[model samples]
Target: MSIKNKVISTLALSGAVLAFSAAVSAQDATPSTMEKTEKVPKRGGHGDKHKMGGRRGMMHGIELSEAQKTQLKAIHEANKPSESAMSEMRELRMAKRAGTLTADQQTRFAAIKAERKSKHAAVKAQIDSILTADQKQQIETRKVEMKQKMQERRELRKQRKANQTETAKPVAG
Candidate 1:
């Protein structure tokens, strides 16, 4: 082959090789066509509690009677904050986020929060009254177990982070 032909052939081969590599890299960077879409749970949403079997699940396990369930539901509904209150809370949250809450609004917001907390405590006490001693004991046991599991997860995360940091550190020559 002529020197010009050899050079042209070599250039074409290098171009093909580079194109192949680029295609592979692009494929690796992009998600696959069959990849499942991840559903991110909304923060502070009602559905979040029951997904992992929260308080309701614990109560269910305790086998509360129909009357108890009905009473609990009624208590929840009766104590539920009004739409106007929710809207006000939302507005206050927005104002707080924007750093624009006035002194009066701040005081009002704190009062609203305190009122909500009291209402929650009251509902909880009412619910406890309905629950049997055995049921409450079971619920407490579950809570303790859950707390321990959470602590274990936290320790594992810390250990993983420490391992990552150690691995990331450069070795001195």
Candidate 2:
């Protein structure tokens, strides 16, 4: 190949490799706490507790009045069905992992998951509507900071895993 052709080919190959790595990294990225909380089972079988803590913390930070807490609790209670559905989905997932779920069971479980996700979004929107613009901004800012911290923690965990894996190799004789 001519020098120019070789250069072009090298650049094209580098671009493709970069694109592939970016896609793979995106797939490997850890889910945010919010996403995990909304999807996964929490420790002690009460995943919603973390979410409730988050809400209460936000309320305290924003200095929500007693009336506001009452209103917020009402909204939360109204959204309890979605939380229950999520718990049910988690149980179904655990059953599937245990290899006891039938195909029909899996299908029903998936449908419930989808429904719960939609309802959860609706509940979030309702809650957001209750907040003032300043409160909304504070919530968004806190969320971003929390996500960044979680990502950093996940990176640390990954580094620890890598170190453990490297240490586990037996030395060659």
Candidate 3:
């Protein structure tokens, strides 16, 4: 081929290769939106049920007695907030997220969150009181595993963001 024709052909081939590689790399580099959506548990779904089951449920999975189940369920029920307070907290969170909350409202929201967290900790302590040393150890192990998994997830998200930012920059000649 003539020199000019050879250069043109080479450029065309390079462009085609870049496009093909981008298409393939895109598929491998990013997770599908559906996959991301599936990773999030549905509200009031199995996740909620598991959380509601609390330490008792976790122990049950490891084979706690019927009496233990009854005790655990009682603990969970007793610790559950009154419906009105739960509703108010939900409303407050929604309002805050919507950017409709004022400074005073934010203060109240912080107080509510603190109160809920304290109550949750108290309930957890009560549940722990019922657990044997082995069961408590098991729960602690599970908590550590969960923390590790969460850390891994955060790192993955950070890496993904960095990759996205790098890819978005314009390539220089």
Candidate 3 CA-lDDT value: 0.81
Model 2 deviation from native, Cα RMSD in Å: 23.1
The top-ranked prediction according to lDDT is 1
Q: What stretches of model 1 exceed 4 Å from their correct place?
A: 1-57
Which is the better candidate, 1 or 3, if ranked by TM-score?
A: 1
Q: What is the TM-score of each candidate against the true structure?
A: 0.63, 0.60, 0.63
Name the candidate, 1 or 3, with the larger lDDT value: 1
- Across 35-114, the per-residue lDDT of candidate 1 in tens digits comes to 64766577877874663245566665678788987887788778878999999999999999999999999999999999
Worst 10 residues of 2 by lDDT: 47-56
Provide C-alpha RMSD values for all models, in order: 6.7, 23.1, 11.3
Q: How are the candidates ranked when ordered by lDDT, highest leading?
A: 1, 3, 2
Residue-level lDDT tens digits of model 2 in 1-173? 89999999999999999999999988947878788779555566744546556644555477565776677888878777756666877888899999999989889998987887898898778877778888888878888888898899999999999999999998899
Ranking by TM-score: 1, 3, 2
On TM-score, the leading prediction is 1
Q: What is the lDDT of residue 79 in candidate 1?
A: 82
- Off-target runs (Cα >4 Å) in candidate 3 are 1-48, 51-61
RMSD of 1: 6.7
